[model samples]
Target: MRGFDTILVVDWSAAEGVRRAERDSIWIGAVRDGMAEKPRPMPTRREAETWLADRIGSEIAAGRRVMAAFDFPFGYPAGFAEAVTGASDPLRLWDWLAERIEDDARGRNNRFEVAADLNRLFPGTGPFWGKPHRDRFPDIPYHGRSRDGHGMAEKRACEVASGASSSVWQLFFNPTVGSQALMGLPMLSRLRRIEGLAVWPFEPVDDAPAVLAEIWPGLIEQAVRGREGIRDMQQVARLAWAFSRLSTAELTDMMDVDAPEEGWILGAGHGPRLTELAMTAPDPMADPPPAARAPLEPPPLSNDCFALPPGVHWTPVDEALDLLRARLSPVAGRETVPAVGADGRILAADAVARRANPPGANSAVDGYGFAHEATGAGPQHLPLIAGRAAAGAPLAGAVPRGQAVRILTGALIPEGVDTVVLEEDTRTDGTAIAFNGPVKRGANTRRAGEDVDAGAVLLPAGHALRPADLALLAATGVAEVEVFRRLRVGVLSTGDELGAPGVDPDPAVTYDANRPMLLALAARWGHEPVDLGHCADDRDALRAVLDGAGTDVIVTSGGASAGDEDHVSALLGETGSLAAWRIALKPGRPLALGIWKGRPVFGVPGNPVAAFTCALIFARPALSLLAGGGWRAPLAMTVPAGFAKRKKAGRREFLRARLRDGRAEVFASEGSGRISGLAWAEGFVELPDGPAEIAPGDPVRFLPYAGFGL
Candidate 1:
């Protein structure tokens, strides 16, 4: 008993002969007293337009609120083209004017001018300008224009319909056209035939009766209870009764299957059943229980434990980062060094200003000045005095009452003087000065301690030396500063297969790119890079070289994998300790993070591309953390895909890509091991572990080079 009571179906075809064609007619069906009904068919557009106007006008006159749903775009007016393109052509006119109006409103901030322009271009006395509403629809869809316009109109209608006045001027449109218009505007909320309900890019059409019945109940309830004054309550009741024949909830169950977890609720009447279901089949979408991780234990450092292969120990990424940070702790002790000119740096100890920036009161301009009390309100020519004060020059003494002193910029103002009259603004009378303008107290004066008060914090610890800092330190009379000692990093390119530049590479060896890259990176980070000669394949030799390198950190390449030839892990076990050797990421999975002789060391993969990727992802962040700088997450942007692809789940992957037309297109060769792939890529497209496959036109997250520590 939930079907529409009154349904008016109107066929909006142009010819009456076409209206007779049942298939082409737009029907408006109504049930109880024009409450709700199915749509009827109308063949002619003229008939449909007349019927729609009459339906809207009648509903307004009867004081019965009607929600008129239209198939065409209602927000954009027909004359909107002239407003958007600034072009006037009858042939290019659209049936809807809302889109153009919205564009105009957004593009111009002057509402008065916009309204005037719209009025002049689209002049009509009808509900929608003088032109027929259907003639205003756009011929071609502008990107997001239709959708944006519809959303704006819907918000306005909903607000008025639910406002304090209970206004009856509410209108609704389904973006779907059918015979339902005949039921009049009252049936606006009853029409529920929408296509692709669960999928995106929804298309609107007259849904089947079976599907309509499922949505009819909600539509009827919303219409009757949502608005006041129904023209035909009896018809609505009958329609509702007919709709009850089908179980509306069962057919629409899929629509609510993936409803968001936040707004979901179980019926109070079915509490017991809900409880049983909750206990038997827990929802995966529900919140999960928090996991309690085991406390970390420091690696054992006994003489026996360092004998050969060290036992494997697992640590969380955060904990491992913390350990590395503590090992590479910044120098706390500070030593004062002579600060000369622009060479002054911030002291480790907080410094207070020994004196004010200006040292004393000063004159900000060159002029004849005197105390306000000394010069009366009436015009008087004061005798010219011959006292001079320049920057750093102390004033000889205060000028007598009617006498004025000459002052210059940055020169300390004499005592008992409050105002200064510019030399050009006065006519000197020999030994006396005459001023026509009135003078105010404290004018043209720079007070002592105005810029920096005495004993104020001039510079703080850990602040880098800058030009301004040096000037302020000089002004404060500080001769030296104390700063934290810079860290020294040892760069080692491991493996017999690697060779330094300038040296001729053997037929079987490759030039070591890691050494130069690491050297430049360490220098950029304010750390001194000490290159340790490459280690040979022999494990004992590698261990000896690592132990002898006297550096805060030892960054090496290769010899970290489980292969017998990879001897860096064994060397670390013999020297210090090995932390983690593998990570849950692509391209750089074979990364080795460890410590050597109390110094942090990173063993990157042998592949040049893999080595750089690992450095960007893990090594850079670890270094920043060790330098007392917090870790910074990379920036992510949502972009559309220019191509389609399917990816495996469980492991996150980064694809090299270039952005074009606001869409990201993957590079031809994105193999992680290929150095050319990394070189050609403008940025990386990060794909998370999920079952969703990417399709062309689908939105994706793009990670630019700056976002990934580049």
Candidate 2:
């Protein structure tokens, strides 16, 4: 599909009303054409609205598609939407919340009161729980055990697939998505009126210019962690990059998902596949020399190339990557190119020296050359010889013993001249040169094969060529080298609300951001990046772009999860090729995976932060293998925790953080919508699958940006 041209990832906050906390507030990140934009910190819900409106308006003005993904739940479980709004359309719930949510600029709102009232809609504790322990209400409870008679499922299907995600009924504590949903749904309701904006799985996925979806940052957080800045900022940036690298086909597959009522997190289930591919992939170094390999082999083509594991839920991030490695392989062809043009290319075979470096013995200094003598360490002199030996012009006759000849650097050593003195150490005379030393035999002269022997291994296969490597190739008489062709990784942003950066600004639209950042990232990592541009939400338009892309893979932002029977969803259904890979992680659950026209496509949330994180954690390594660079596993280091934190069990989480005083300090908020936290973070502090209560000075694992090649 044409996919999304821009990605905007948001991390939402619910710190207001009864309590006015201000740690991790609203954060918005934008990625245009594979390039990440500066994250914006929204201090208030009102300011966040204006910021979104203006940015989205600009994107719409420029005719780009935008996918704006919020970290909070886009909708409650199936029955809750209907119960609250008396309508099947969850968007109606947005309207309901908008009418009742009383919010202001100073982080004050009546969310608790509204939630309490909503809880009263049904008999007995109608499911709103996790309120503050000290604050009590007629129906709301501080603990789930205190509630009763709630008919709806406590956790949505997406949450169940996420393994250990908190129930939506839980409004506070333990990384629940409910509190933010209470605070953010109203904003979504207001923004719904923006031109071309459509709620995913609630409207035609491809019919609109802008698509709104839910996102979870945790999926990629585990693979590509950070701790240099606030945890929130880094995840969004990383997530944005991840989505921007997906192919049009991949995006289409993601858009073909079936989550209708309860929303799904973007890029969740796909992490395992990426991890698998990176971990189990055959080493690029194992490839035979280009001359010894068979002809180019094509990748497998099938409707189910991206099939998600059936009946599997709660997959860890590492497991997801492992699956991907099992399913994918190098997709590029081998070709020969001049050694000089091979820089930045992945070698298809080991490189061997054709000839020894320095070819033969030569002079190492510009001075008089003479036979060495076993004399004492004192002044010595030799009579002048016949002619000078300059580089590319060696003296024709051999030098006699006790006689000397002037030799320039790189000049071939004259026969019988075993040593040469430095010009600085010799006294120049008309017929003779003098130096104070007992010159050692064979000194100041290079010997044959001194640097490298003929037919020696110069470089291993799969090694990415660099300038220094070229020097070795040149010295070894290697004029041509075989390398794998660059992988064509493409990106597209969906939604009508996206436009070029300088369009007329509105408070509801966003400018293009994801495409630019992703393309640059691919290029930096030595892959051929293709900009597929923006496509409207219409499935036909997206299909047209997909057919013309001619890329090996495409990444899409937005439209991963569409409304009930959305056009894009139907399109995928008709092809019977779309699958949702649901992973067990916070911030991410079901990721889009699919195939179209033999090209692999993956869809990522338009949220810049989530998209970027997914790209690094999953897409980067996958592309590395596809581009014949082999699988890439990001490096991580053990570090100390600078702050205290309590994390729930059954899921892994990567918190954006910065290293301070040799310890990891996590972001103030866990909201995935907060892109500012990502910007502030340098790496992530990875928490294990089991529950953990970390205190100050405790051990932790930190994944830096450099580790992921960021």
Best by TM-score: 2
- Model 1 has an lDDT value of 0.48
Give one clash count per candidate, in the order shown: 99, 130
Candidate 2 — which residues are off by over 4 angstroms?
Answer: 1-293, 301-305, 373-380, 423-430, 433-438, 496-504, 562-576
Question: Which residue ranges in model 1 land beyond 4 Å of their true spot?
Answer: 1-328, 331-333, 341-347, 366-369, 372-384, 400-403, 418-444, 505-507, 585-587, 616-710
TM-score of every model? 0.47, 0.55
The global C-alpha lDDT for each of the candidates, from Candidate 1 onward, is 0.48, 0.74
Residue-level lDDT of model 1, residues 1-710, one tens digit each, is: 11211223222221123344444455343322222222334444434444544444332222122222232111122333445356542112222222232212112222122233434443231111111233442321122223223211222222232231211112222222111211221122222222111110011112211111111212233323433322123223323333223233531332232212111111212223223322332122232222112111223223232122245343333333334433433322245576663242323443557788778888888887787777666686777677577787857877777678777888888876777777677776566767775677777887787666566546433344567777887787777665544446777777777776758857676878777777776666555678886877888788788889987667887887878888887766554455445554566666565666566778888777777766665666555434323232345788999878787765456777778988999878657556677667777787765545899989888878766535
**What is the Cα root-mean-square deviation between model 2 and the actual structure?**
27.2
lDDT of 2: 0.74
Candidate 2, residues 1-710: lDDT per residue as tens digits?
35676788888888863222323757676666444555555656776787687666645543346788888888777788888778777777888899999888567888889988998787777588877764677568877788888787877776667564666677878676778898889999989898668887667776466788887776665644534556676556556656666777876676676777777766556766433322332222232223444457555457776676677756788777776655666678888899997889987765889999888889898888887862337888778876899999989999998788889999988887878888888897869887898778777899777777676557645567889999999999999998888889889888877787777588577877778878888888898999999877788898888789899888887777666423344456567887666556655554576777776777766677677777777788788877766566666788888999898898887788889989999899988778788789997787888999999999998999777777
